[model samples]
Target: MLPDALFSLTALLYVAATASFARYLAAPADGMDGAKVAEEGRRDVRLGTGLLAGAGVFHAAHILVFSLVLAVCPVEGIHFPLSVVAMLTVLFFVVLRGRFRIDAAGAVVAPFALSALLASRFVGMNAAPSTQVRSALLPFHVAFNLFGIALFSLACAAAGLYLVQERLLKRKQIFGLFKRLPPLDALDRAEHRFLLAGFPLLTLGILSGTAWAQKVEQGGLSDLLRAGFGWATWLTFAAVLLLRAAAGWRGRRAAWGTIAGFASSLVVLAIYLGRGGPGGHS
Candidate 1:
């Protein structure tokens, strides 16, 4: 009963925050002066950020209560992982939004966070494995992957904004929404840094997953496909990094690579929760 109520409350908070962020992105149809727009934008962003921060607090409480109710570790299964990833992503965004000057990007972050939270309640619940199938490495694997995915989510959002801003600049269209977003170069650097930071955690998670898979002897075409996506996500980001350093791939090329890598990562995650675990059902 308590869990249900908390979940409901968390959903409400996220929905409210998402709404606030959407308002934050609305441009004045009247062509307001630059100073007036910046002032209004900052007000909306602060309210949205405060609401998101409140939602994150409730999100953490939900996880704690859930772990207690289920008598399971918070990191053990699908629902918590999905929830935690969204919460962490929110926390990270709130902290860095000012430094990165990416307040408008909250349009992407808030909605995704809400959807992931909803997915936790509806989709990930039934996918929990039975006790016998549980592995010690599972918590470690999920924790690291959750962190990696959170970073990847941010990287993907930044890369997407970078692409949009880049296109606008090349066409010489600026001011209005473009003026409100983070600078193009900052978004690119933040995307690259996020990718760099997350790659090692993803690598570790994959290694642990492999060990667990071997221990359980879970093999077949489904497992192979899941593993393939995991590997593909890793290699795609790796190529992005490598090409960036060696071949100077930035702007559209690098943005595309990051988006491709993020899509592969999402497939890997979707396969996990949408189906089941490593031994996903056909």
Candidate 2:
């Protein structure tokens, strides 16, 4: 009951945060009183950030209590992956939003958190890994992957906003939303830094997952497809970084690369969750 209540409260917090961010993005900037509009927008961002931080705390509590009630490690079950990732993503955004000046990306993050939270409740809620596929390394693999994916989600948000802001600049329509977005360079740098931080974790996750798969000797089609997409995600990010260093790819090109890589990661996650339950795969 306590977990359920926490869940409900957390959901409300996320909803309120999402609304706050939406209001910030939609706030008019063309009026003669631009100073007042700007101040109001900043207030909305602060409120959204605070609400998201509170939601993250409640989210962690819900996960802990719910896992205890079920007698399962949060990292051991397929059920908790999305929820954990969403929580980490929110926490990451709340921490780095100010530093990176990417607070505007909250418009993407809040709805994503809400969606992932709801999806987690209904998907694989009772699933657990089978004995055959269970291994000591499973938690490490999942943890690394979850954290990497969370960072990738943030990178994607920044990259996406960068593209929007860049397009607006190109078209010279810099009045409303454009004025509110973080500078293009800041978004690009944030995206790149996020990808850089996440890449090593993702590499570790892939290595651990490979070792676990070999230990179980699992070569099913689903496993193959998941591995394929996983590698594709890694390779895409690698190329993005490599090209940026070698060919000086930045801004628009780098943003698109980050988005593409994140999309691949999402495909891998979708496959994982779509495999029915814990009996499916590790």
Candidate 3:
């Protein structure tokens, strides 16, 4: 019951933060020559940041409580790890806000807040083996994959925004949105960094997954299929890297690639969940 209440509160706080972020992003940043747009943007950011900070505290507490309940690291598996990843990203974003005008970037970051909140709801509801899944190699795999996906998710959001901004730029109709978005150089570099960091983690995840599957004594075929799908996701991300490196895929195409890879990985998760996930029909 306490967990449920915490989950519900976290979700409400996330929704509130998302709304505040949207307001912050949607507020005008243009025509500051004589207008109060900067003041308004600052106000919106302050409100949104405050709400986001509150949500972050709740989320951190939830993880701490969950860890205590389980008597293990709260980031036990893919799901819990994802929640941690999202939480850390929020932390990073908050810390960086002072260095950069990232208020408008909230629109790019809020979905992660929502995702983390949703993931938190399942923390204890699932009856799967929540014991410490310790394999020295396995932990490495999970760690890399979690960070990779977290970074990629951020990239996905930024890429989506980049596409929109690029389109508006190409169309030469960017008076409003143009002023609102981050500089094109910033967006481009962001995409590059995500791919640069994410590609290796994804590669390692694929390798570790294969190693884990090969060691399985039963359900060889099904496990192979599952791992195959994971590899497929890895391959897609690899291609995204290649494209970004060699073919110069950016903006809309890069965004689609990231989304596709993430979706494929999600399908792998769905299979896991459907078979025997926490609170899943096992």
Q: Pick the candidate with the highest TM-score.
A: 2
Among all windows of ten consecutive residues in candidate 1, which has the lowest summed lDDT? 273-282
lDDT tens string, model 1, 1-282? 887788788888888888887776666525777778788888877888888888888888888898899876777765677788898888888888777777777878888889988888776676656565587888888888889999999999999999999988998877776767778988998888889988998999899988988988877776777789999998999999999999999878999999999999989887787666544453
Clashing pairs in 1: none
RMSD of 1: 1.8
Which of the two candidates, 1 or 3, achieves a greater lDDT against the reference? 1
**Candidate 3 clash pair list:** 126-278, 126-279
TM-score for each candidate, following the candidate numbering? 0.93, 0.96, 0.81
Clashing pairs in 2: none
List candidate 1 segments past 4 Å from native. 278-282
- RMSD of each predicted structure: 1.8, 1.5, 3.5
- Which runs in model 3 stand beyond 4 Å of their true positions? 1-9, 28-35, 77-82, 95-102, 119-124, 130-134, 218-222, 277-282
lDDT of 3 by residue, 126-200 (tens): 544333334556667666776777777666666776777888889997565676666665766676676677878
Give candidate 2 misplaced runs (Cα > 4 Å). 33-35, 277-282
Q: Which ten residues in a row have the lowest lDDT in candidate 3?
A: 273-282
